[model samples]
Target: MRKFTEEVKPSRAVFVKWPLGHPFGEPFKVRQHNAVIRKAFEALKTIKKPGTIIDLPFRWRRDEDWEDKN
Candidate 1:
C-alpha cells in the first residue's frame, strides 16, 4: 500500500523504499535485513519532532534485476 504514515503524523517513523512484500530485502539477505531493523530502532531513539519521517538509504534491486539464484 502507498505509505500512509503521513496521516498518522507519527512523532517518529522510518520509511523504506523496498518492494511491497519484501520490505527488508529478499529472503535470507541477513545484512540488508539487519540494516532495515537497525535504522528503524535508531530513528525511534533519535527523532524528536512530530511527523519526522526517515527514508532509509538502502535501495532494492529492480524486480527485473532480482535473481532467484537460490
Candidate 2:
C-alpha cells in the first residue's frame, strides 16, 4: 500500500515492508509489535512534512532475534 499511500497523500505514515495483513508484525510477538508502535509514535513526533512516509527498518523474516536488539 505504499503506492496507495503515495497517491492518496495522507498527512503522515509509517511504512513497514511486512506481509499485507501483518502490519504490526506476527501475532503474539509483543516485542515486534511494540517496536512498530514505537516507530509510529516516533514518526508522529518527528515527521515534519505532509504525506511523509517513514520507511521502517524492520525486515519481514530476518535471522536475528528482534528481542535481543533495541
Candidate 3:
C-alpha cells in the first residue's frame, strides 16, 4: 500500500464497499451502488487538507472488487 501510495502520490484517496466482481454492488443494484459512492464522497467532504487517507466506514466484500466495474 505504501509503495502504491508513493507511486501515485495522490492528494486524497477513497475506498468503497462492494464485493469481488461487483464494484457497483451487484448488477442493477443502483441503491447499494450509490450508497457506496456516497459514503466515499462523504469521507472526502471531511478532509480539509491534502494527503488525507480516509479508511471509509464501509468495506468491499473482497479486495478483488476493487477492480470490478458494475
Candidate 4:
C-alpha cells in the first residue's frame, strides 16, 4: 500500500482498513462508503505531516464469523 501510494504521490494519504480493491467500502454499501469518505475528508483537514500514512480503524468482518479452516 505504501509502495503504491509513494508511486502515485497524492496530496495526502488516507489508508482505510478495508480490502485492497474496496478502498472506501464494499461495492453497494452506501453507509460504509459514506463513513469512509467522511473519515478521509476529516483526515485530509487535520493531517500534519505531508507523506504521513493514517490507517482508519475499521474491520471488514467480525472475529468469529468467517475463517479459513485450512
Query: Best lDDT goes to which candidate?
Result: 2
The TM-scores, one per candidate, come to: 0.73, 0.85, 0.50, 0.69
Stretches of candidate 3 off by over 4 Å are 1-6, 17-22, 59-70
Model 2 residue 52 CA deviation (Å) reads 0.5
lDDT of all the models against the reference? 0.70, 0.81, 0.57, 0.65
Per-residue C-alpha lDDT of model 2 across residues 1-70, encoded as one tens digit per residue = 7898899898889988888998888888888888878878888879999889998778887625455544
Error of 1 at 34 (Å): 0.4
The collision pairs in model 2 are none
Q: Write the per-residue lDDT of candidate 1 for residues 1-63, one digit (tens) a residue.
A: 325877878788888777788877889876666767777788887898878999765667643
Best by TM-score: 2
| Candidate 4 C-alpha lDDT tens digits along 1-70 | 6578878877787776556787866677666667667767777788887876676666685322112211
Which digits, one per residue and each the tens of the lDDT, describe model 3 over residues 4-70?
A: 5546867776643334456446677566577667656666677778776665444544434333432
Clashes per candidate (backbone, < 3 Å):
0, 0, 0, 0
Weakest ten-residue segment in model 1 by summed lDDT: 61-70
Spell out the clash pairs found in candidate 3. none
Candidate with the larger lDDT of 3 and 4 = 4
| Candidate 2 global lDDT | 0.81
When sorted by TM-score, best at the front, the candidate numbers are 2, 1, 4, 3
Model 1 TM = 0.73
